[model samples]
Target: VGVERTFPVHTPVIDEIKIITRGDVRRAKLYYLRELRGKKAKIKEKRDIRPGAKAAPAAKAAPAAPSEA
Candidate 1:
């Protein structure tokens, strides 16, 4: 998770495996899974620390002015 690797999944020709999901891992590895299982194997759910991260801001919305006859 936190650690970066060079030869872990190195490819010389082209392709290898397909990643299904990219987890928001807190630690370098999920080594705790060896002993823990079921409920204990679960990691704490991570939340967005960024403000207004749910959606992107509207495209610079401006106040419309009333037209005169």
Candidate 2:
């Protein structure tokens, strides 16, 4: 048994995200992530940066409205 968690990653500039596998190698990190012994061994795909994609509003988010009594 192991602990598993999922979190939201807010990357606004993610317009046309495409995942492409460089190669089907046994190594996970293409360096040594494959030499591990366990079910946590897997070659994850790399996320390539999209061209002409605009990043989300560079400005910080506005504050929420104040509550009224």
**How much lDDT does each candidate structure score?**
0.63, 0.53
The sequence of per-residue lDDT tens digits that candidate 1 reaches over residues 1-69 is 344344655766557777544556677977676676578766665666687654544533555789999
Candidate 1 lDDT score at position 35: 76
Predicted candidate 2 versus true structure: per-residue lDDT over 1-69, tens digit per residue: 555454445666555645445445654445465356575565556454675332542333556689999
lDDT of 2 at 45: 61
Which number leads on TM-score? 1
Each prediction's TM-score against the native? Answer: 0.39, 0.24
What's each prediction's clash count? 0, 0
Q: Model 1: clashing residue pairs?
A: none
Candidate 2 local Cα displacement, residue 58, angstroms:
38
Q: Poorest 10 consecutive residues of model 1 by lDDT?
A: 53-62
